[model samples]
Each structure stands twice: as structure tokens, then as C-alpha cells.
Target chain A: MLNQLARDVKASMSIYDAGDDKVYGLLAEFAHPGELLHAAEAVREAGFRHFDTHSPFPIHGMDKAMGLGNSIVGWITLGGGITGLSLATLMQWWMGAVDYPINISGKPFFAVEPSIPIMFELTVLLASLATAAGMFALNGLPRPYNPLFYSKNFARVTDDAFFLHIAASDTKFDRDATAQMLEKLGASNVETIHDHGVEDQD
Target chain B: MSTASTDKTLAHLADFHDEAPLVKGNLTFHDITEIVSSHTEKKTPFAWYGAFSLALAGLMLLVGMIAYLFWNGTGVWGLNNPVGWGYAIVNFVFWVGIGHAGTLISAILFLFRQQWRTAINRSAEAMTIFAVICALVFPTIHVGRVWAIYWTLPLPNQMNMWPQFKSPLLWDVFAVSTYFTVSLVFWYIGLVPDLASMRDRAKGKLRKLVLGVASMGWTGANRHWRNYEKAYLLLAALATPLVLSVHSVVSFDFAVSIVPGWHTTIFPPYFVAGAIFSGFAMVVTLLVIARKIYGVENIITVDHLEKMNIIILLTGTMVGFAYITEFFIAWYSGVQYEQYAFVNRMFGPYAWAYWTMMSCNLFFPQFFWFKKLRRNITFMFIISIFVNIGMWFERFVITVTSLHRDYLPSSWDYYTPTAVDVLTFVGTFGLFFTLFLLFLRFMPMVAVAEVKGIMPEADPHFYDHEGDGHHAEHAVEPSTQQ
Candidate 1:
């Protein structure tokens, strides 16, 4: 099968090549998690920055390996909570104590203790709303379409498979060389997956 | 990858052939029905439905009782003067107190990270809403003027009136309503996914329409779960403090007063603790019967009941502590009226009521120290009913005993329930059972999905070898926020 594919590739490209003409990139096989770690580290060490991982389940320490850190969600929550507290306090006080302080129990208008419960409730309400809004913004949800969906086999990722892909658009491109590198690093069944709908970038 | 392939190869035969492979690796949409309904496929025990129908008929009696009370003035009940609140308030507080366990089980136990709570929390949450429903009824009618009750609200009208904002009664309106709304949203949101599962499982039109609308457009996508989780966490966080505040505000109704026994600083914590004590006990009572009737005993294990018993014991102790502290404080404060109120509570005309309150709330729950009794179904049920009795008497003693003999004795009146009070109280129980029986028949009665999620087998990704049991420290994620 490899010899036939090699012959066809050489004929289609119309470049050089005769016997033993080899294709690049071709994912050889899936990697063990440990092997994937090693390969990812090698990719980083070799100064290749663009790559992606697909796994049926999330792996521990994946974020650190991907160099992701720190969500800004906390700041949004804090700010929203502060705003809520202020708004609740102001609204209650203005309406209940400040504006129409018709003496009912002969207590002072701005009785702080009675107000505490409402204050606590508003603070939490606002903080939670902020968190939900911030989460939506950060996740970039409701996108309707994602580039990852272009892969027909990618749907299996949520089931029983694990995968890793390196794109042709990478600066370290030499399709044959990259495929050879991936195969040497222990991918299970190296194959070049074409993303047909990708833009015709010059 | 090599390690995983080798691992898969080692267990491939077992994975395909074994009835229990220690994990169910992947489940598509089709897998859900098989997972839930396989055991349920045969004709259901028609006896369960038959029993439920009988209970529903009993519930209709409660509805009839309520209708009688509403049409007639509150006079149809025995309530007059001193015992105006009588069984109605008792039932109100009783039902409200019972509701605490539901939200507590859902939110507090969840925050505490108790995985065992998953089996019962969903039903307990439903109980919370229904209990609140029973609770709200007493307050609405107890005023003796149901329609004119809106006069309490602050609205501009021809009469030029506004609710006394300083009144604890007014605060109760906000507190109870807020708690109800929050619990409802929480319970409904929790039900959505389960309802969707029910929708998927439905075969006939009845199941399809009911579940489909109830599910609120859930699609079971992973992202939906991710978002729902975050929202649920936030709700749990919000509910925790709200739970604390609700009972405290309710307590303020008595605490803020200058009336002898009614006025005390300890009321807030005391009431909160008692609410939880009674609530947990109620959950045990309900879950025990529910598990037996539903044939779901394995899902609700002895461990779950034992854990709830511990809560009942702890909260019972706290309630006991509050009682002692209030007594000591009354004596120490040396205020003559307050002192009289304390002494009168024990030896006054209503002393039988006082003793009944003490023994029921404080005395019986102590038996939980013996683990055998806590797990013993009959004894726990009896004690739970006793707690209900004691809690009612406690309210009775506080309201009547304290007020009957005021600073001016001539103005004091001995309160007693008319036949009206007795019937009204019975009707409230009718109302409570009516709602509960309906819930059991219609709803899942247990959170099937949550239970499945908590099962160790659901987490196949955690292990490579079948039944490796290496996850000794996963620690069940400790039942975190509901």
C-alpha cells in the first residue's frame, strides 16, 4: 500500500522521485500518553510552536503542557459583586430609609442590621451573573462552526480514541520531513489528513 | 499509547464478554435507555401504583379540608385569642422546617461534598418546594383576612395604608418568598437534565409530551453539561447563605419583640439549628419510606441514613444547647418579666405543652447515639414523628406560655384551640401528604442520572486495567456544594 501511494503521490506532484519515494508527515500511529508527553516536549524543544492534541478524555497537567494559565473570571466576579452590593444597598436605602422614612417602629431609617441579608443576597446574585457572562465570553461559545469540525474522524475524540495533529501551515513545514519526524517520534499509523475546506491562503 | 494498547489487549476478552467489566467505557445516546430501563422493563410492581393512588385519594381529603377553611372564616378552626396561630403556625413552621433538609441536602450537603446525598437530594429538593407550599398556606390565612392581607404590602391606595416595615411579619414575607424562589429555580434547573433523560426513555405520547416540555430543550451535549455545572455551582454558593439568612429572619419575628419569652437573642441560631435538625430527620423519614416503596434500597444505603442521623443528632444537640442558653440568659439578665417568662414556661398553665416540646425535640433524638437505633427503621420513624410533635409544642409554649401571663395579668388570657384549630391543623397535614403523594407518582422520585454519575463505574477514564482499584484517594470528591 505504501509503495502504491508513493508512486501515485510522485506522479500527481510531477516532481522528482523514482523508487522508494517516501511521503512526509503521515501519522504512523497514536501515541501513548507518556509518549505523547515526550513528543510534545520534543516539539517544543525543536522550536515548533503550532500543534494540537485531541483526546477522548482530558488529561491532568494538559494545561501546563499547553502553556495555559490563569483565568480572568475571578476579577469579573469580584467587580460584578461589588457593583451588585452597591446597587442593592443604594436601592434599598433610598427607598426604605432615605426617601420615605415614615416612622413605623420608631427605629432609625438606615438600620444596617436589617439590610445585611439583602446586601448579601445582591452581592452573590451579581457575582454569579458576572461569572456566567464572563465564562461565555472567554469560551467563545455559540460559534456555530469550528475549524476542528472539518475533520470527519475528529468526532471519535469524544468516544474511544486519542489523536495529535500537526498542520501544514506550520513555519517548520516540509511535508515529507515533518511526517518522517512524527513517525520517528512514535505515532501509530502516520497518515496525512487533508483539510479540504481550509482557505486558499497565498 | 503503547501502555494503553497493551492494557486494552490484556483485558479485551473481559471487556467484550464480562457482564461486569468494572467500567462502561463509552455511552452513546442509545446507551442511556439501556443503562436506566433494563431492570425496569418488565411490568412495574402494579402494587406500587395502586398504593400511590390510594395515597392520592388521601391527599384529596387535605384539599377538601383547605377548601372548607378558605370558604368559612378561620373561625371554622378552633383558633381564638391566644391560640390564634395554633396548628396552622405549627404546621407552617413544621412544613418550613421540614423543607430545610431538602435544600440542605441539595446545597449544603453538596457543598460539604457528600456523594451519598446524590440518591436522595433530588427528592429532598422536591420536598423542599412542597413543604414551603404547605408552610405558606398557614401564614396567608392565619391573618383571618386572606384577601385584605394585601393591605400589609406597601402600596398607594384609597385607604392610605402601608405594611408595618418594622414588623417581623413583614420581613417573613420577603424571607420565605425569596427562599421559595431560589429553591424552586435550583430544583427545576437540577431536574432539567433528568427530565431530558426521561424524555429519551419515553415510549408513549404521555411520557413524550410531559418529559419533552419539562426538559426545557436539553440536548445532552458536553458543553451544556459544562455550562450547567458552573451555573449549579453558583446556585449552591448563593443558596448556602440564603439558607442561613432565611431562618434567622424568621427567628427575628420573635427575637426582636420585647414580649417576655418571645424576645431572646438566641432565637436565630437556635431556630436555624432546629430547622436543620428537624429537616434532616424529615429527610430520613421520607427517604426511608420512599426507598422501601420505590424498591430503591440499594441506591439509598444504610450509610446514607447513618450520615443523616448524625446530622439530626448534631443539630439536635445544638438545639438543646440553645434551650439551655436561653434559660440561663433569662435568669442571668435578672429582668423580672423575662425571669417570669422562663419560670412560667416550665410550670405555667401550658407546662404539659412545654414538657412535650422538651422531650420530643431534645430527648428522643439522643437515641441516635446508638448506631443500631439510627439505622433501625421503625424507631427512627417513631422518633421523627416525635420530633415533629416536640417542635410544634416548642412553638406553642413560646407563643402562648410567654404571652398568656404578661406584665399586666388582667390583660392576659388563657389560649385554647377550638375544634376549628384541630381540624385546620389536620388539614395542613392533608395538604402536605397530598403534594408528596403526587410527587412520588409523577416524578422520578430519585435522581437516576446523579446516582449513575456518582457510581465509580461511570469514570472509566480513570483506569487502564479493569478493576485496578488504584483510585483509593479519589475520596468521592467529598460531597461539595449541592
Candidate 2:
């Protein structure tokens, strides 16, 4: 009974199995950004949650069409900026006032007036770094392995082509039904893509 | 899709505004990708090789001169009693000023939603990073002891000596270093999507591997782009004030001091204006050559150059006004030392330098006010070169003139740069150009994803709402239609 349960869990978690030549998902190519956007809205309305649209550039209003909300990157950057400000202030106060104070023209130690420049610089630097890192982390980037790469036609997604991908892991995914829906929505081509599985990669 | 159909959609969009198209030639996204990527994918051109060789030679000269300077000392340069600061400080300020134009275009103009910046922001940002590197070399070597450079930082030494936080020079270390780091991060973030495009279109394993690593497997997912765009906007917001603060801090290095000509409240704004003026001139100088050689003139159009020239004219006028204001204030203050500094600058040994600065920075840019002159490629290019020369002299005049004639008449002397000083300054050019040439050779000089984003075809409603005669409410504003 335990062995059967283990097998069932493995099957449910396996989105793709290259060893068995298992299908990954349906990859559909659209003619342009407008078609892709509309198709994404249709797929969302059709009850598919595990889908994404791809284009060479960010299409304005794509997030709305895909049912995504405002990104949390701004809050992340603000947190980072506050952290930077606190650290800069503490470091300056500790060093100048507590640790190794110096008397320069009788000016007070650890004054805020003179420390504003460094404080501002650190805030900007940390905020920028946090923004970039938060963006990458939120997107789950550096994920070089994706089933859509198996489609040769998908190469143009970064050039001129637009694509919509519906993962097989979706509970509503019916292979034939998904392909047909994509075709009806004006997709120029729809193909089943697979995960060739992991190998030695750079 | 056919080019005609794309043009038709673009024309429909243009009905909102009478402005010219930002991207010329009615090129498609594929054409843009092909044009930008082929420079990296194909074999290197002879012209590139020639330019690289010359730049490499200059880099070598710079390296050798630094080695010689290290062997000797700061005394090797013409550092006299009063004019202890010479070519080193002048060159540092000059190069740092040149770096400002890049950040201005990439960050400030981005915040303003200037669509034309898409054509030149990538290369301009790259130039900013390289120019900062060159600017840094002088300060590092000028300390006369390269190995002890860590003393400038607030590291915990055995002696427990922390950097004096009150010093403007220390403020400079933090400000410039912070500027360099933030600019680098900003530039790299912009390059990721373009690098991903290069990766997808790549042929070789090594090339693919390198780009794959650099791009972080960017797939242009809407999920990713949503976050990416937000990050880009936030970074632009952060960098705008940071750019302004950087030049202001640099001006503080002089303004906070008790020097007769340097101690003025006007230095910060004046310095910032001059930096932008010189930076725009430098960008114009480089883009004119780069676009012609790479056959990307259609992408980076004459309209872009005309816009940049207008900025140069505006900033040049501001700088000239500051110059006049300085003289007037010196006379009105009735401080004999300050009054003498201005008189000496105009009629002193460095008068030639001051007038050269006036002609290049103040006089030449006035011609750009005329539409024909602004649009004339050869004329603008010449004016850009003159502006570069004039800005350099501006720094020289400010640094040398104030110091040469001290309050004590006996210490007044005419300062001259040795051959070492002159050659070391020239070598910095080599350092700047070598990095720039390598960048042009390997990287996408134009931001491909950004340029595509601005194209008419990238609009979501361009195809869906066509012929309905009712555009979406979120359609690009008429003012930003370009």
C-alpha cells in the first residue's frame, strides 16, 4: 500500500519525463502580439491556470490579459532601501561617535547633515540591486530548462513570433481539446512539446 | 506579417500625432534583430579591427606610462608649490563629466517617456561604464601609492583608522564608487533580454553557453516581463537623482574648499550643467561614427541627433550663463582675492585656456540653434569635437588658474604639464576606446528588446482593434506617439 502511494505521488509531481518520451504540453504560435494577448485571455477564461504568453518585448496590458497583478518589486526595493539607510547611519555613528571619534574643526561626531550624501548613495545602490534581484527571483529566472524549447518554431519567440504555452500539469488540460481551442483562437500552429530531460548543461 | 500591413497599423497609430516615426525604414522586428545581432554573429569587420588595434595601442601606452609613474612619483608630473593639482584632477573631472550623458539618456529620459532614447540608450550606458573606468584610473594612480588605496575605504585596519567622513574627498570615493556600481547594474539589467535574443539565435555551443549564462534563461514570459518592467522603472527613478548627486558631489570636492574661484555656491549646478553638455556632445560624437560604420543609420536616425543637439544647445547656454554669473559675483563681492582670481583667469597665463573653453563650450553650441546646423551631420560632429575640447579646457582653467596665483604674491607661478602628464591623459582615451570597441564588437550596441517594445507592431491593439475605428483607452498618448 505504501509503495503504491509513493508511485502515485511521483507520477503527480512529474510534469515531464524525458526518459519515457512523455508529452510536456501544447505550444501554440500566434501571428502577433494582439492575437497572443486575446488568446491568453481566452485560455484564462477557458479555466486553464498553468499557461503563459511569450513575446520578444513586453506587450502593454499583457499582465491584465494573463490575470496577473502588479509586481511586488517596488516593495522589495523599498525594503532594501530602508535597510541600506539604517546600515549606513549605524555604521557612520558607530565609527565616528563611538569607535574612533576625531575632532575636526570642533564639528560634532556623527552629525546627520554631513552624512546625508553617503546615506543617499547607499539607499540608491541597495534599492537598485534589490529591484533587479527581486525581479529575477519572482520570475524564477535562470531556469534554462523549459519544454517549449523543444519546439523548433519557438526559436522566433525572441525575434518576431508570439507563443502561448499550456502546461500538461493543468488539471483541465485535455491534449486534443487544448490544441483545438488554440487553433480556433487563430493560432498559426499548435504542436505537442516534450521535455527531453536533463543532461550535461553549461 | 507583411511590411505593408505593419506600416498600415503604424500609420493608423500616427493619426494621433504629427511626429515622425522613431524607427525609420519601416523595418520589422526580425529585421531589427538581424541588423543588431549580425554584428556579433558574423566575422569582425576590417574597420573594427583597425579601430581596435589603435585603441589597444593607446591602452598599452596608458599602462606603460602608469608603470613609469609608479616607478618614479607624483613629482614626475608638473606639480608645483601652489598648483599641486594638475592634469590628474582635470582629467578625472573631465571623464566623469562625459559619463553623465549616458545616465541622463538611460534614466532621466526614460522616466520622461522619451521614445527616441531606445535607439541609443544601450551604447550610451556602455560608454558611461567605460568612461567611469577611465575616470577612476587617475584618482587611483594620483595617490602616488597604488597599493595603499584601501586606506580610502572604511575597512577595519589593525591601527583602527577609519576614513575621515567629513572630507569631501571621502564623500567623493563613496559617491563615484556608488555611481559606478549602480550604473553597471542598470546597464546589465537592460542587456539581459537582448542577450537572451542573441542566445536563441546563436549557432555555436560556446556562444550559446556564454549568452545563456548572461541572460539567466530569459524566455520573455509575461510573468517575467511584468516584474522586469517594474524593476526597470524603479531603477530609472533611483538613477535619476543619483546621477544629479554624483556631479554635485564632484563639485563639492572643489566648492567645499577655501580656494578663491572654487568656493562658490554656483559650482554644483554649473558642474551638473557642464557635465550634461559635455556628455551629450560625447554621445553625439560616438553615435555619429558608430551608426555610419555599423550601417544602423536608419535605426539611429537624424531626428535622434537633432534632439540631442538641442539638449547640447540648452545646456551650453546654461553653462555660459553660469560663467558670466561667476565673473559678476566675483566683482560684486568686493573680495580682493576673489576679484583678483577672475581678473587673473582672464588676463593671466591661462587666458588662452579660458578663451578656448569659451569658444568651444559657449560659442560653438549657439550654431545648433539653427535647424540646418543641428541637422547637418558634418557640422554637428565638428561642434561635438569642439565641445569636448572646450570642456576639458574648462576644467583646466578652473583647477590651474585658481591655484597658480595664491594670496601670497611670492608663490604665484606659471604651471605647465610635463610630457608625462600629457601622455598619461591621452592614454586614458585609449583605455576608454578599447573597452568601447570591445563592447561594440561583442554586444548588441542597440537595445533590441527596448527598440522592439517602442515599435508600432508591439502594440496589443494594433491588430485586434484595427478597422474598428475605436482604439483602446490605454493606447499610447498622442504626445508620446513617436
All candidates' TM-scores?
Answer: 0.72, 0.93
**C-alpha-based local distance difference test score of model 1:** 0.64
**Interface RMSD of candidate 1?**
10.0
lDDT score for candidate 2 against the true structure: 0.88
User: lDDT per residue, candidate 2, B1-482, as tens digits?
Assistant: 34445555666666444466788885778889989999999998898889999999999999999999999999889999999899999999999999999999999999988888999999999999999999999999999889999999999999988888888888889889999999999999999999999999999999999998999888888878888999999999999999999999999999999999999999999999999999999999999999999989989999999999999999999999999999999999999999999999898888999999999999999999899999999999999999999999999999999999969999898899999999999999999999999999999999999999887778777754454634444343211111
Q: Per-prediction TM-score of chain B? A: 0.85, 0.95
For residues A102-158, write the lDDT of model 1, one tens digit per residue. 775577776777777666666766766676565444444333333343444443333
In order, what fnat does every candidate score? Answer: 0.03, 0.79
Question: Model 2, B431: alpha-carbon shift in Å?
Answer: 0.7
Look at candidate 1 and tell me the lDDT of residue A45: 61
